[model samples]
Every structure is written in C-alpha cells, then in structure tokens.
Target: MRLIPLLALWLCLTCQSALAAPVRVLNIIVGEWPPFVAEQSKQHGPVAHLIRDLFKEAGYEVKFHFAPWGRVYSLAANSQLYDATAVWMYKPEREQDFLFSEAVLQEQFVFFSLKARKLQAERLEQIIGMRLGGDIAYSYGPELDKMVADGKVTQQKVTDVKQNFGKLLRDRIDLYPQELRVGLAELQSQLDPASAALITHSQTPFLRNDSFVMFPRKMPDSAKLRDQFNQQLQQAIASGRYQRYFERLARGEY
Candidate 1:
C-alpha cells in the first residue's frame, strides 16, 4: 500500500512539472545538408545557429536533435518529437501540422551547367529535353515536383550535393540545381581553384528565387513561440548580430 501511494505521487509530480514549465525548444531537428544543416550526430548548421540564438535571447533553453531530412520533418509533423526546424519555404499542405515563423534570411537556388550547354537551355521550360541532376526528390516547389513525377525531364537524384557536382563536372547531366551559397562553399572545399572554376556555370545570376530560415512550427506552444521568434529576429537583424552570424558561417567560422 505504501509503495503504491508513493509511485502514484511521483507520477503526478512528473506530469505536473511537464505541464507547468514553459517550452523552451524542448527539441530542435534538422536535415543532412551541410552548410545549410548537416551532422553525423550533432545538429549545427548555419540556419541552426540563427535559431539557437533567437530562442536563447527570448529566455528559452533549447536542445538539438539529429535525423535524416525526411524523417526529421515527418517526426515533427506527426509525433511532436521536436519543437521547431529551420530554413524551408512555407508550404500550405504542411500548414495544419506545423507553424511558420517569419523569414529570418533569404536564399536562392538556380540551375547550373557547363558553359557550352548554355546554347541549348535558358530557362525551366527549356530543360524539358535535357537530363537534370538534383538532390533526389529535392523540393523546388509543389508544381516542380509534379513536373518530375509526371516525367517532364530525366532526373538523376543523388545522395548529396557533392554528387551533383561530380555529375556536372563529368557532363553526366546537362544541368543541376543547387543553392548558390552552398554550391560555392562546396566547390571551394572539394576542388582546386582553377578546376573548380571550370566545373559548372550558373545562368549568369540565380534563376530561381527562394528565401530561407529561422522557422520553427511544431512545438506545443507553436503559435505563441513563433510570434516571439519573429520579434527577436527583426531586432537581431537591426542590431547587426544577425549579419555577423551569417558572415561568420559563410566564411566557415562557425
């Protein structure tokens, strides 16, 4: 009788503690794309760093978690395993299952090809007849994915962005779509200066436009938290800390 009563008391106390505490990002999760977000075990990415500081300044403590891109998102959207994630464009289909904070940073992805292939392709429509290399089921948009599923162009989906670079270098595919910031970083790390320069050519400037990061929308108090996040994000950018963080990470200091 005594042991039973004690066990019940402990359970009640545990539940009460959980219910009473404000959620300070009980969990953070990200996908496996380095420079953006990638880790074999830990969860540190350029976008992740922005989120870390944003919540920290808002008086919330957070912990980081790791999972593959698809699994991390599905777990958050389904099981509530994490409170937030960073750097994805907003999607209406996922709106009910997740919350979106304001855009903290902007990024763009564009098509790349060897200089010679320029004569054949100039825009998304022109790629219809050419083979395209991408990060495999990579999201450009809902309509873009539909195009792939409908077999408008041949897609060579690779495991990582590096593989896409290789295919581009070898002329295995005529075009590859990649984020400009990330692509430049990877080329610097993987190839000699001259070799890297000759590897691929983007369409002079970025063709596809997309904004990224500082979004988290799956916590218990997602709405309240997202609002708080946006305020801090605006202030962070105004105060210069945000720009510094981006610069440091782009330079690989973080």
Candidate 2:
C-alpha cells in the first residue's frame, strides 16, 4: 500500500512538469546600449534581464542580436528581416512598426568634449562649428537638429560609440554627443580603459530625459507580449527589485 501511494505521487509530479507550457520567441535585433542592453553578454544589462524575465513569465522565448542602432530601427520598421529590438527612443514615425510596452526606464542625453577645445556650451548655440559625433539616425532634439541644419554644428555619423570614443581619444572630434549613463557603460564595455578614459561627459544635456524599450511589430504575439511586459514591469518597479541591479552598475558590476 505504501509503495502504491508513492508511485502515484511520482506520476502526478511528472504529469505536472510535462504539462508546463513553452514559449516560442522570434529573433530580436538590438544595439549595445549599455545599462540597457550590452551585446557582449546576452544576460548583461538591466533591460535585457527584465525583457527575458517578463516574456518568460508570459510563456514566450526570446532571442536578441546586436548591431548599430540604425539597423535595429530598420529591422523593427521592416519586420521582415528581424523580429524585435531594445531601448528605442519613441519616434512618431516608428509608431506603426513597433508594439511598445510602457517604458522600462528613462535615459538622459550628455556630451563629451575635449577640454583643450574650450568647447563650453550652456546652450545649443555654443556648440556651433564643432564636429559632433554620434551613431547615425539617432535623434538629437529640435535645437541640435537646427544646429546641424544650419551648419552651426558639424555632424559626424559613426557606426558605434566604441569607434567614436577612439576618435575622441585621438582628438579627431570635438565632442561625442550622447546620454550620460548609457555612454559610460558602452564605453566601459566595448573599449579599453586607455581609449574609454579620453572621453568625458560635460553633463550639459541636449535632451534631458527620454524613454525606451524592447519592441516587436511583426509577431502575432505583439499585443500579448506588450501586456505581459507591462504587468511584470509594474511588479518590478513596485517591489524595487530592479534598483539592486543599478546599484551593481554603480559598482562596475556590468
């Protein structure tokens, strides 16, 4: 009698395990926007971790690929070549392509200048005539765009922050216009200290705060995934579960 009961319990456990559902995630394309998504380690950043957990809870598999931000945007827009990407700044034109959940975090814009250039600018006008380095297709706001259009600030479009930081170290450009936290992490992850140290954020933001995310357009699970993410995100924020990771970021945990 004892053996019969034990056998039944074992079978029940096996059945429950077998009944667990599996999630099928499509390929996602993203860029190495550190503290958000670091390409080197798929599991490295906060956003990446949040994305993995949220979708997993919702019973979906996830796959992420890293490249230049322009390509990531293109993939999300077209939807044929790739399935999703992370940390996209909200653009009105892109609203059609991506099914975005509520933002996971807000990013701040920052500028890195060569001290010798005397490139001090309290406002947009001060950056006139200096070469501003950035990834192609990124938004710099109305003031910066106006400067670029008027030829007040010479714009240099590069493939990634790694290369641009090299240029900054070499004094090839005046400033690397970027977000403070993201820039620091990208620099630290992709470049050696010798090269990364050359750039310094001036803390003068062209755009102070912007929201971003993991976005999917082509997938049938688009709406479902967004809802799942939002639900999990709310829980994470409420519990202060995510702040521990940022503390690691401060301690160079990435």
Top of the candidates by lDDT: 2
Regions of candidate 1 where Cα sits further than 4 Å from its true position: 1-25, 40-43, 115-121, 191-197, 204-219, 250-252
Q: How far is each candidate from the true structure, as Cα RMSD in Å? A: 7.0, 3.3
Per-residue C-alpha lDDT of model 2 across residues 1-254, encoded as one tens digit per residue? 89999999999999999998655765677777776678664475767877777667767777877777777787766656555677766767677778777876676787886555666865676777888788887877666877888888888888877778878878878878887887877776778876665556765577865565645666666676677778977887789876766676677666
RMSD of 1: 7.0
Residue-by-residue lDDT tens digits, candidate 1, 153-180: 7888877777888888888988877777
Give the Cα error of residue 253 in candidate 2, in Å: 2.3
- Indicate the worst ten consecutive residues by lDDT in candidate 2: 208-217
| Candidate 1: worst-modelled 10 consecutive residues by lDDT | 206-215
Q: How accurate is candidate 2 locally (lDDT)?
A: 0.73
